[model samples]
Target chain A: MVRSKFFVSLISSLGIIALSVAWMPVPDAAAADPNTFNRLMKPPSKRNPPPTQDGIHDPGSIGTQGLQTPREAFKPLPPAQSGNYVDWVKAFDAKKIQPRFDSKDPKAKPVIMDLTIVRQVKGSMPDVIFPHKQHTEWLDCSNCHPVPFVPQKGANQMSMASIMLGESCGVCHGKVAFPVADCRRCHTETKGKATKTSAKAAAKPAKSKKK
Target chain B: MQATIHITKLRLLPVAMLLLVGSAAVRAEFGDIVLNNVSEQQGMRPVIFQHWFHRIRFQCRVCHNELKFEMRVGATQVTMDQISQGRFCGACHNGEIAWTVENCDLCHTGKPGLTTKIQGGHETKGPGIW
Candidate 1:
């Protein structure tokens, strides 16, 4: 009878151990293909993979061989901590990459707007400083206006939760531009101690051209 | 001896269950979308659309506005017939702007038996309670 009781306890303990192991948070790499996991959390070695190996293009395709690898292309660009590890804003400012403003008309120049929008957030987190100069360098105003963001200030209500759900700034920030992991990049303004640049920008009213 | 054998069999149950749960935890990275609306039925792999690559070349307005691609996944019924006629993907993929659709494997690179879904990285929601 004692042997049977010992076996029951052993089986129960083993079951508990198994349950705990199963419930333990699996590492992101273990859950999926490391290469195909979230790019934001990718190790430095896997950040800028080749065209064929990046999982976007077919490895067997002949065209994949001809395409340039991100590592080679981003060598001269400003380095970053996440995503493709290329600081696109710095690269644009430094003239390392001049993205065409208009796809159809190569000669068309972007209507550069030097503006900034400061969003005050609750809690100890720093306020957000949305810079139009950096964004307009590569994108047109229509890319964001009237869609994810309204032209007028305070017209759109935004929150971290909505952004995570792929709304508002998240439409691009976490997808094409940069992942939200780089929080300090946007939330740069401290409470009651606004930087000179942001303070000057906040003074000017947002100018929106009606179509 | 009999109790020992029974204990081993019972222990195997949780081990098997753990494996089952682990296999179900499939996930995808940010900007990756698995488009398999009609691929598997036609003996083709689902297309893995990478938003990062295309956005690097053209602005969001180019595809979202000019191409009229809905923001939601699987919202646009992209068909080969529409593509060949210079609509949707064919606008730039018609041998002049970008690669022609003749090379099928380039776009359709997703694993077999997957469905249309955005493989968005959930971690982008930021840490802690919002």
Candidate 2:
């Protein structure tokens, strides 16, 4: 009778210990039953693993103001911050251009193309003036000529939507080259332009064909 | 079950078509080159050449002009035997300048045997194993 009483006490003690353990901060149970157990109980080491060499470190943990930091709060380059409208253009022009050497043809002279393309994109924005001379000075003509933007005008329909989706001008612009955020850089002319209405006129034929 | 299978196939069709269209419109990015000749048959991943890494150090004309690397993919026939004998990619990657063929993962990108340095289990003393 005494042994039986001792056995009952031992079982009760084990039950109480198990209940206490369950009630206590159990990280394993927290992972298994996240809804019931608090996630804070998870060990710091397991919750936040040490960043691998190749893996990008968390910006929030690195003391950077997480997502709320304004881009304009940071100081831009001197040329970018300049009040003068033609500061970047003037600066680019002022710099002495280097001649590109071709290994295949030693005598090949660098062909400097100075042409301007004025594309009218309806009322969404002003006409985009593309300066060929500026781009050609840095890059080869083959970089964009035959493929992305055909040499022939009206061959390709370049829209703002397409550019935003990394097509045509977007292949270089907003990537390796200067970004498309600076409005005044491309759209220099603030004056109202005459409308050709060629986009609508071109669309009518396709629409009629579909009908 | 038949209806579910049909619906799944119908859902998959657009994704497959998009993949096809996406692959068809492959423009030459700075560091993107797909080389798949004998690699797939020999149980190896195709080589993905990084043009950007090479271009930063050397001009475009250096490889295209001097090395005679063809413009199109699979235009130049480069064998492992030829490579070891100082031909094609081996011109620079002959252990003297760039990383040799023993470091397969550098060109192979992601592969099953990426952990080990030498490829195909056994290392060939000479080009006789080709």
Candidate 3:
């Protein structure tokens, strides 16, 4: 009788061990990647925490600037009083907010240009209108001049793949600046006539405008 | 023999509990930093600076205060040109203290997608995990 009792207890003990092992928390799958875990331990506050409702994805933060994410990024933003990008640009122009400079130099005037050039990619999503004044408010002319883009017109070869890879406008758009998720932000030309005129202007051979 | 088995079984419970607690603490302790300033724009890989790798030997004040690195990501413009001149990371990585910039792949693993298979939880896998 004692032997049978002991046998039953042994089986129960083994079953408990098995159950505990199963209950153990599984390690993050990212932990399995060997190239990443150079050291056994890591420092705190380095990992990019999951986006919270009140985090960078907050709607108050989203405006004329690029939305952080397509889903949660758009929901939190305030309702637009004016649907037109031109009106928004006009409002900024009226305010007369000069270009921001890291260093104050009176001689270095901010380049205020009111030109909007539409770049149409045949059969792609709506053509994007390149806005100059909006960008000048935050960045210096040297930031994107001559390097990422040549001063001459149509010099930079911009594509969706390149932007996603963090090239061209993707450098600031997807990173700390703004994201390129909101297609409507750049494709503001809502009329069919404007699209055709810009398309024709671009296709005209050797009418390159010098900077 | 039965008493011995019972004691062993009782002991195992605490061990399992301790293990669960230990792992949870360790997983929460480590966090990774993604440094991408002009790297992607310049056709180079962004540097992923892991804190644990440096924390084991140095204190937080060394990099945070002494080195003048901002707590926020992308705030400090760490250019390769600056790094080569012994400014931020270049201070220690002057070939005397740590590995030099000549060993580019050690830190500049380009895009994280090309490096390691990143799982969910916003956790990424890249080079320099060693």
Highest DockQ scorer: 1
Candidate order by DockQ, highest to lowest? 1, 3, 2
All models, RMSD in angstroms:
9.3, 18.0, 16.3
What candidate 2 gets wrong by more than 4 Å, as runs, is: A1-110, A137-139, A164-167, A170-211, B1-41, B45-52, B58-105, B111-130
Considering summed lDDT, which 10 consecutive residues are worst modelled in model 1 chain B? B121-130
TM-score for each model: 0.68, 0.37, 0.36
Ten-residue region with minimum lDDT total, candidate 1 chain A: A202-211
Error of 3 at B86 (Å): 15
Better of 1 and 2 by lDDT: 1
Q: State what share of the real interface contacts each candidate retains.
A: 0.15, 0.01, 0.00
Residue-wise C-alpha lDDT for candidate 2, range A9-102, written one tens digit per residue:
5565556555545533344534676576445442323221122110121222321122121122211212342111112333334532222234
- Candidate 3 residue spans exceeding 4 A from truth: A1-100, A104-109, A198-211, B1-130
lDDT of 2 by residue, B1-130 (tens): 6555545555555455545543332322222345656665667655645433453334443455456664334567777788888777777787766669886645654222222111211111111111
> What is the per-residue lDDT of model 1 for residues B1-130, given as tens digits with 9 covering 90 to 100?
8777766667676667655654443433346677777877788767777665665566555676678776656778898889999998898899988889998877776655556765544334321112
Q: Please write out the lDDT profile of model 3 over residues B3-44, one tens digit for every residue.
A: 767656665665676556433422211233456656666676
Cα lDDT, all candidates: 0.66, 0.45, 0.47
Q: For this target, which candidate reaches the highest lDDT against the unseen true structure?
A: 1
**Candidates arranged by lDDT, highest first:** 1, 3, 2
